[model samples]
Target chain A: MNSNTRPVADPRPAFVENPEQADQQQALGRRIITDGIRTVFLVGCGGSLAAYGPSVYTLDNRVPQLVVQAMNSDEFNYRKPAGLGPTSIVLVGSHTGTTAETVRAIDTAKAAGAESVVSLTSDPESPLATHADLAFTDRPTKWAWDPKEIAMARITQGILDAAGLAASGFDEALAALPADIPNVFADLDPALHRIAEDLATKPVTYALGSGPMEGMARAFAMFYMQEMLWRHAAAYNAGEFLHGPFEMTESQAPYLVLCGEDATRPMTDRALGFLNRYSEHVHVIDSREFRLAGVPDGVRAEIAPIVMSAVTTRLAQHLEAVLDHDLSTRRYMFSVEY
Target chain B: MNSNTRPVADPRPAFVENPEQADQQQALGRRIITDGIRTVFLVGCGGSLAAYGPSVYTLDNRVPQLVVQAMNSDEFNYRKPAGLGPTSIVLVGSHTGTTAETVRAIDTAKAAGAESVVSLTSDPESPLATHADLAFTDRPTKWAWDPKEIAMARITQGILDAAGLAASGFDEALAALPADIPNVFADLDPALHRIAEDLATKPVTYALGSGPMEGMARAFAMFYMQEMLWRHAAAYNAGEFLHGPFEMTESQAPYLVLCGEDATRPMTDRALGFLNRYSEHVHVIDSREFRLAGVPDGVRAEIAPIVMSAVTTRLAQHLEAVLDHDLSTRRYMFSVEY
Candidate 1:
């Protein structure tokens, strides 16, 4: 069967079956500290790249001792950073583990003499996982905050914990995700269905978010809408939306605003205020609205981006159902070679 | 006269007349070294924030000793990094020097006990300049790579030189800009007029670039096309464009691809190849086409983005003329408050 013709599956989170995966992630972190790694470079493509948002945001805000950077995999390989040497660790992600640039990033890291190369993907047998010094494979998932992001977040938590910068409740939050994520879907599904219906025929959709949630916005706008549905869409940082893209507000284009319970919430709030006044087709998915039972308050904001990503994924699913479009279909991706 | 009602002048560069401005920038860098500043946070809004791209890219690639970051002013203030304390310097930019969040970022920087607060703005008397510990003022210009970006680039060079990581030809290239930029306009005008006319009636235009040139892509798509022309436009990092947004290629949308003579040129080259195969309305502005007289080959790529920015600005000017839409016209910004 042609992979491009595969039917769209319902979006859902998939977890690693091996409980020792957590220990493995911790071991990776211990290796970084033990090896005297001073920098961590996160490189990936598309939604895989977006999955690093929460972890990057957390590291940027909380872990000040180490240098952290995120880049699209191809750019990472092309503009090789001067800092990515023996004192650096490269964490690369790709859902299929066959993304050409991501697989090459492992080679790039090795070429740069990085202390270690880690990969997160669903296909354990693929090139990316086979090439990396360490690989974490989870069950395949088509949604955000699933196998890849969950493992990536766990790996980041492991790194932070190893560095003595671990925040309380982070581990607890991770443990609770299995039970908590289903509740998030149940709570969000109805609203998402309504949103999908409203947005189905819109000329163009604009997704806006700030800070960590901005990644989810990009995932929804670029990956889901443009790639999956072949719909016109674009994502903008909320603060930046005010700077220029706000001109489209009065155009009455549909909008999806992801509001995470982080410090950058005010930016989305400000944009929302203007959006509500100027456009009638505005849909907001606020992370604060959902309660993840076992996740405590301190870590909620840290993990809100992941939850919001999950919501956007479910919304994309609803749009797929309503529009009768297969998410796997593509015009040029693998069908016609460039 | 209401600033909003003012006529749109032909876009051009306005520079600072003070030779001592360069000395002041070098002195600022010297202070950073003397005060043991370890982190340099570049904060701004809209085009102001985009101006820091090349400097960020350069610092990340050439000088790995310091922690360098760029963020929207609001996000910078909201998610204040734990690292932003006594050993940090905050460089903020705003064209009018009165952007609310940029002014607030100065307070945020001061409250965090940063070593110094630097403001780059056209208005010396504005609150941002008035409150910042050090302010650099330049002549007002409504375009990319003009007063703000030039000053920011100079400041970056100063920091690099102070840290003994100075690359040869950077200063020589800076010195050549005044004479070189007008030639860029002359060189690009005919092609740009055609591009502007071709793009004027398009429902949406997409801009793509890689590495240093990506900043110019964003400035053109967001600041120029969206804000100034009130048109729908979006920018994609050329490498990332393949990840998802490339799905729009066959839609026959007009695309503006900026190619610079940099390591990441191949990323854009790959995208341009795919674009050429898939789309008919692809317009490319390659920096290698322009001979920046005094800028040696070593530093040409570093300054290529600035030149590409000038070309895009010229393109926007032609767009404004062809569309019969005043670039200064705005529906909501400063008109009806949110």
Candidate 2:
């Protein structure tokens, strides 16, 4: 069993060193501004696309001069938005640089005369990288935070800086982010174990988050719980929870709320409050608990999604241990052709 | 029990006659283009906000010059995107025109110097309407398609017409849409009854859709199943289903696929194909079954969501009957304050 499956008293997150790479991340954003790109499409399949959620949300709020959207790679290719040519930039991601749909999306973007097609992938020789105008490749990591999200943030920072809307201390905070992520696993080990024990045998579990944290919540419920552990799970935007899904509160299903420090935290809190009163199985995985060390308070909320992503990953691992399910076991994913 | 609860041999959907109203719907869209409103914010709470999903998707694909977004009312009020200024327009909705968050959002929009704030609600004297610079109030309808969606469409049409990207026969299609919605109820009753009978006792259910049909899929799972029927349910974008949630296919949970006739239909088909193979509990609710008379084939896919919304609403009533659950029965919605 992996160390993640077995809790240590003084558990330290296993660290995988991200190899030093050329700083090609910011080139996409810089080129976007230089080429007068009016629209930016962040496209990828599954979790690869999810990696850009927070960055897209932040860009939508911070840089109005640039219209930024995160779309599923398959849908983007099929619909092909009217704004996708000449003055547009398409940023896509795939860990192995071999997601077929994403590769097709990049090819289609290039064919449509998009000003730039940028890819973030681990394999420099992969089609996604070779087919794009520019590519940012790094060593693959287990968790999505390091190479993928960090590269996404850097490109985002470039856009904000170019538009004179850069968040103060954002660069330093992001640079220090990877080093601090492990600390979250160590700190939350005890809490995660307890929560996982409670939820292990539950037939269904839910993850909830709002604003920038929504993508991570979905990754936790759908990817980590359902996909990895083969458990029935789902995620909801905390803002929309009360509108419908909260009616299941009396079902006693375990609920985990990713309470980030962003402005949408209150939306999370409201749903949390309702769930807390109505159901006993409620866990709040707040970003405030993370030891981000020197990250400024002003930018703390901005990066909360990254920290919270680590927390969910650890929690999923704990659940795997308690449930005695192998994380890599799947019935149909790579086993069957659709 | 309502006729919806007990399937009629020839189920005719109950129609509430909508009174004739002013043609003020297109005014907002016209002003937006004339005043150079570059950003459009469609804001509302719960299902109110969901009603704008297809319109927003269509606009996003059709109008590159306009940045359009559908945001939860509370989150919109809190984050108040940096783009909310004299060049922006905010369109909000609330059934009773008193959704506190939506009203406050309009107030905040005005305070931020947004070019205009338009309110679409059923109450002309409501705060959401009274606080806005322009109000399009209509008689409330049982289904969201009539007054709410039609008004939303008219404004979208106005924008498209004004921007010179108008879909031919769109106005005629929308005007004729409400009259043909009941035909979907008559056509789908038998299929829905079989599906509901199979799903009535299932502990969990899922609804899947892609692109323009996504919002209705969500409404089916979250609003119809979870809230109204008090069933454990969730909705997923068909495009993203393969990424993670498809792992639950082996569980044999009841699956409902909202197959719209849009470009994204293939994405839904891919998931439906897998689900049909692995899970016996699968139902396909195709929008093509809806007879939208006089609507041209060119715009049929565009209006698929509106038709599917009616189908899901009718199916929910059937579930309510078979499950012996009152659609209005709720433990916390209006009973307790958060």
Candidate 3:
């Protein structure tokens, strides 16, 4: 566990205090089903949308009644979904709630026939939250566990419940998820520091995961490593990595494999074995190693990705510490308009 | 454009001579509609699935009646879709038709109720083709504009046609498409060599596009660069690049932007502008530059991705020449099993 720097804030704490917000969001989700909403567009940009991948996959597989689609903010705003309109629910996800495309997508969604809008963000004051029909806000953190993700899961649960496909007591299980910010570095896991130290100056790095954890692995490599740390890195699905990306692997290039306990563990384990053979710097972050305090075994598989994010959040920060790079450094994000 | 090497064969030449095969596939697609197939699961692994991206996007937005789902072979094999069954069509895509997950996915799809199966591959004797109810075979090509991709497009066209959801005269336009193998080097485009020279030694390269071109862009980066050239690279959607990935776009890093002439052109153009200001190595490949011979304007819009693939296939080969890297060079692909 990391202890030298301030721990990243948990986005879920504010949700515990404002339990009504979840209820309101859940009611909105259920209403969408009851009201005959034809489509639910889970809309956002970059990290916001990538983070919702697991939820989308779950929602698509679990609730087959509703046509669930994830749209990129700019494309959603540029041409927009033809199916969007009064009977469509556009759920806009933006951590800052200030992403220009997502902010515009809310209005665009409505203009395109979005009758119900659910804004998931950290800032209630942001344009998206201010204008949405239901605003699910949590305490803001630039790079941390997305509290709104949990809220989105709850909302999706309500949708499932209304559709008569709820995963027996899934809502209660979701509500019971820990609200406490994790001490990811409290134990100072050697793997975390080892990856950061070894990859401090590596020319390029790769991360891999499968199942719902693919999103978390992507966030770690694309968001935290490339976006925050400005490191040269890439992320691939564990299965696809062997199919094509293995050629790029060598002794110098490191592979950070996120071995989450899920249906795809064997595939990732195979990747790890291959990386271990070919690459000198193979960092493995297995969810089984970390004690996810207060997280029940029932909801653990579904939420393992959320746990992976919290763990990698610390790893990204530790990487910054080793490289002497500030996470706040930016090149044209919020600083300049495209 | 490329004069020194043998021109890559167009995969559709056999289709012209074997017209009855297409009629058989079209009859199958029509039967899918007649039989009331409710869902279409377009399944494949990395490059195979990535290549069908444009067709899928077009089908998704255009053919709203059918639930069109694209699934990874491993994911589909592990947690087969609950919606799969006799009312569903599983279109298995693999260049070699030897992908293990895909082979299992076919049986899983059948077990889950896939009544009609369409196997798209180069080898008719392959496991997927041998087991599938309908196999659409094309002549094989490795690390080039996938021959299977053309076959997949025709099958999708037939599916769209059966549903009466196809664009106006789309089939006529498709039939008129030239069978002439694209001499991507006919014009001897310098940009291909420029991109290869610029990125020959770059530690990391980023590729981006939208719509069907997004898949082509992904294939070029993941399949061509990483898998074929043994180069380190990553690919992302054009619109998403601005939301977070811009942070990694330093002056030194090259950004290969595929600006296709589609609805998403403006979005890619916006990204190109941003990359121009930030990165020195910004390679833009726009489909409008290449005139796909004998293709009508109406079909060109939909078939632009096939054209894009043809154009970039040369770029991949050119990169090999500049880097002196053989396209067949592999660490584990066919040489060893994982």
User: Once superposed on the true structure, which residue ranges of model 3 sit more than 4 Å away at CA?
Assistant: A1-17, A82-87, A139-144, A164-185, B1-17, B140-144, B172-184
**Candidate 3 lDDT over residue span B1-338, tens digit each:** 22354433323222342466767766766676777877788888877887668767776666556667887888777666657777788889888888988988888887887777788887889998898888877654343355565666766777778888766655665555444334334553577777877887687789999877778888888989999988778898888778767887888888888877777788898888888988888988877766556666666678778767767777877777777667777878887767
| Winning model by DockQ | 2
Give per-model TM-scores: 0.94, 0.94, 0.91
Q: By the TM-score metric, which is better: model 1 or model 3?
A: 1
Model 2 ranges off by over 4 Å: A1-22, A140-145, B1-22, B140-145
lDDT of 2 by residue, B169-278 (tens): 87777667656776667677889878988888687888889998888888788887888887888888897888888887864578889898888889999998899888
lDDT of 2 at B315: 81
Clashing pairs in 2: none
Docking class of 3: medium
Q: What is the C-alpha lDDT profile of model 2 across A126-155, one tens digit per residue?
A: 998898888887754543444677778778
Write the residue-wise lDDT of candidate 3 on A123-202 in tens digits.
Answer: 88988899887787875443345576777777777787798876664655455445423444455445676778888768
Q: What lDDT score is found at residue B39 in candidate 3? A: 78
lDDT of 1 at A228: 81
